[model samples]
Target: MLRFFRWYCKPDLIEDIEGDLLANFHRTLRQEGPAKAKRKLAIQIILLFRPGIIRIFNLSGFQDHFKLIQHFVISWRRIKSNLTFSLINIGGLGVGMAIAMLIGLWVWDELSFNKSFTNYTELAQLYQNRTFDGQTGTYKIVPQPMSRD
Candidate 1:
């Protein structure tokens, strides 16, 4: 299998190489022992760089390889579908981040509003209820009231 992989530069040759390697490794293990088989397989893998060694398989062009073709087709399909989905995902994430940032800024601003005031310790909010269209609404007003100690 290693020989086949070293021979075929095409992507699809991976599966054939893997299968071949497994079959040869198992055969070697059965014929010899585990240690010898491992050593032999390792030697074969190492020797794969030798010229004219893997050329005996004579595999065709990369595009002719079924695995490469299948991968290309699948990738093309995903690219088409992912274009719109990816845009939506990015837009949603951007909007969500912006909203979160704005809320954080608002909270920070509100908290810091009275911090620099000279009468910060005496600051208080007064709550008043008003009726409009038969509905009651409550609002808080600054500089309104404080509790006596």
Candidate 2:
């Protein structure tokens, strides 16, 4: 993770930030347990997976800003020249992203089902087996107490 962080971090801020992270990791390890320290380090590294934290590709010194503006201008001109194709691409991308977001939310909710309850740990789904038409079937809809308490 640290190696990935080094590869991903902005080149200008790598040295000082990496050193500080290492120092903080060691401090956390000493103050807290290994699990907490590892969690902290992992969280920090994950947080760096953002565009602002990633290294910029610009290498030119003074012309970088001009290059950026020129790049945007060229992009805008291309889009304008291919307005129909560009709109279609943008619409497809927007629909795909919206569908992906909705699926992600659904999966998150399903995984976290019943987690909001204070006594979720004590709760359990009850199941029962019954014979119907010479066949045995199991069902989770049986009426039963969720917890012993």
Off-target runs (Cα >4 Å) in candidate 2 are 1-62, 118-143, 146-149
Off by over 4 Å in 1: 1-81, 135-138, 142-149
- Candidate 2 C-alpha lDDT tens digits along 1-149: 79889888998888988888889899999999799998999898898689888987656766988898999999999999999999999999999999999999999986786898987776666678999999999987856564467
Superposed Cα deviation of residue 81, candidate 2 (Å): 1.0
Q: How close is candidate 2 to the true structure, as a TM-score?
A: 0.42
The residue pairs in collision within model 1 are none
Candidate 1's C-alpha lDDT? Answer: 0.72
In order, what is each prediction's RMSD in angstroms?
14.4, 22.6
Q: Worst ten-residue run, lDDT, model 1? A: 49-58
Candidate 1 lDDT, tens digit per residue, 20-123?
76788899999998998888787767665454433445456754797788998997788688998867878999999999999999999877767777777766
Per-residue error for 85 in candidate 2, Å, reads 0.7
Against the hidden true structure, what lDDT does model 2 obtain? 0.87
